[model samples]
Target: MSHTFDDQTHGADITRLFPEQATDTRSHPSRPKRGDLAASTADALAAAGAATLICTGHCKSEIQHVIDHISRKYKKVNMVFVTADTSSLASFHEAGRTIKKMGLQIDGFIGFPSVMAVPWEMTGDGHESHFQRNYLCYFLLVNILLDDMVHGSRVVLVTSCVRTEAPAPTWVDVRFSNGEDYHCLEGYSQSMLAMILFAKSLSKMCGDRSIAAFSANPGNTKTNVQTYISMDQMESWLERKRIEGEEIPVSLQQTPKSLAQGSATILRGLLDPDLQEESGAFLNHCQALKLPHLDFPAGEESAQALWRRSQEFLGAFL
Candidate 1:
């Protein structure tokens, strides 16, 4: 059977797990009822008579509400809410095993998991920074499910361009052993940067495998993904930036896209026949982010480094 975990049970810890959670856990101030990309994608899947696997993770109620709220408008897709947390590689393995037992077939896999911009938090399993948890755990699950996917499988990871806001990672301490030494986003930047390389490297590994890997930048959406940034924290950072004569981060300054617009970008990459031949493409707002200022993976070297570290963390699981 599929897993289901409710957010209500967490009570206090819900704030930590979902730092952006509003005063009312039942409904968020920023959460849009309709027109968000995520629900729209689910609706599209349901319309195509496809089944959906919603991994609610730590925010069960919110994700479940999205699935239910949208499934009602669509064809009522066969969705399974995965209550298990994808915070660790071991959990990824268990979820894979469970899916295998249920005889489920996955055609498209999308991950929108993320966390706060606070100081680096270590994982209990590998003692890796929490920043990597969002990407690494999903990477493990994809590896585990690779053999299960038929040809033409699509793996889309919702990453951020905010990574460019920070500098490159030091090879030795990429896990941020000296996290306190870096700015809040510095470590997060490293993690997000690793995701880009991971996407590029995954495409290389998929050569002749008929599988495609893509990284999606939903652009600025008023989602809880940034809820980790509290108002007080924002003020403090803004004051610091002013004193330092630095401009506020655009991501923090602007209004976010509607949920519909954000998810549309991912849908374009996943279902757009124009992208059928595309692999390892990084998308922003449903188009190839061609901004000259933004950097994609430079060479095979850094991609390899990320792939190596990922495999090292995952070990035989890959």
Candidate 2:
């Protein structure tokens, strides 16, 4: 969504309201540190003296910058970048084998690959583009790497407030009727909601192993996630959200976070010690906020149904 904000409330500096913990080479901070220092995948792995497998897309430049920062600061941390497009199922399978061959014990996995508001199409894997790319592929990858995730490890599935803004998924037809009834916003929202539910399922499935999984809403930042959103589509989505939230500029996006601010909520889910006991919690702006979908009985039923369906669909990969 909408990035519009009230000039009166936030003033000139939007970062003032959504303060970031540390700075990185990119406009956004790489990660929020556990202590006073800045946090990154490198920093976390270094602290634990463990190996981690990071899966990313579209932000490779930013990741390379983090790799550079790690070399200079945390010399002990070893970083490896693998190119795996989440849109393709075969790509994830190869990536999983690559990690396994490295014998890397995955200490933390932060999945940041997602697309929004794209026109409907089926992926080569014979699934809806949004479902396959945004949710299913990641679902398969996580299950594929489940063997490597050690005790007390963390998994962050980046989600969005759009999950709440758009029309909830019709469980009977989440993939949509061959794009006939598909609305870009609805499709994106459905995937995001599946992510939230999947995080909960992941936490429960890990059980005694203590692999914490959380779905984080990074607020709103101007990122490549909006690349597919055209000006006309943006206006229509904003108008719809405005009517729903009944607030100027719409509240779904929440005052437009900086790249750093958006990254902070994600880092919190990954490294924040305070959230250790809050596994499967949905982090909104770095806090555990109860969403309407999760708070109701029907929502829980939908989540269970989704998890079961996803497991069946991705059974071969798992």
Candidate 3:
């Protein structure tokens, strides 16, 4: 909940980051709807010869809208949604049931049977009980997807952002499968780090042409996720909200954009021709963002370490 980035480091050069231009400019003519975006993206990917489309999260209606548009326009592009709930196992199971009932054939799945306690247990003890349940879901979801990497599929992992400088006001002494006890918000950081590592590993294991992995931050948008916060916290957030506040620039938040608009960047990454050769890079708003250079370099070694630990923790189900 803390919006402070006071202690965070920002060395990524923003000037070098730019979104890829759409091939057919008219199809995407400025802030298109979910359907139009999907149609344009599907067309682009088809033109580029992409085999399948994989999308994450609970935006089924939006995803379906886009697919329907694509089918109408292109006639023959396959798409699938791997519904996942990072919140709890119960939620994920429920989603699975829904997907099954709808009779949609999901080619692959990456989800938890229960929520992870790593982030909560590593955030520090004697804080709010709810914080443990809240942030831990993100870790659970990412771990699920990483465990289910197929050799020849395009994988997309979606996660929310936890401000780097915020105090992880929960428990802070949990041991991961690697036998390391992390402190502060290290669990959240580890999850993000693990995501990149997993992607890098998958790329290498599959000989670069078989698989691709990428992570995306959806940015702050109006969604059902806000409902998870308590009433008191919600009121506090509203009270802290300002017409022109320091937390979020007014110009950015006030724009006529919805979550669908925010998802455009993600769509671009999955469809852009330029990205086919680009692997192991974190993307935002359809542009490659420089990750915090970790002590271990990005390659197979880091990926193996992360994969081993994740598999050990996730157990045989993955």
Best by lDDT: 2
Q: Once superposed on the true structure, which residue ranges of model 1 sit more than 4 Å away at CA?
A: 1-40, 54-63, 70-72, 162-170, 224-227, 230-255, 290-297
Residue 30 accuracy (lDDT) in model 2: 22
Q: Write the per-residue lDDT of candidate 3 for residues 9-59, one digit (tens) a residue.
A: 111111112222222111111112253323343444434333444444444
- Per-residue alpha-carbon lDDT of candidate 2 for residues 1-318, written as tens digits (9 for 90 to 100): 123322122111232232221111011122222221123333433334333324344345635656565556656545566656766787877777777787666656666535678888888877888787878877877888889777777788877774443333447787788888777876887888888888887877786898888887766566534545776776786676667673435334457655555656666666555577788878776677776656334366777788788878777777
Cα displacement (Å) at residue 278, model 1: 2.9
TM-score per prediction, in order, is 0.73, 0.74, 0.45
lDDT, candidate 2, equals 0.62
For residues 1-318, could you state the per-residue lDDT of candidate 1 as single tens digits? 122222112212222232221111111011113454455545544444454444435445756676676567654445565544646667666766666565555566776645546665677665445455657877776777677665666677777654234333435666555555555555555666666666667777875876777777766666534646766656665576668676666465435665555665665555444465667777765565542222444446656666777778778676
Q: Regarding TM-score, does 1 or 2 come out ahead?
A: 2
- Compare the candidates by TM-score and give the number of the best one: 2
Model 1 RMSD in Å is 10.6
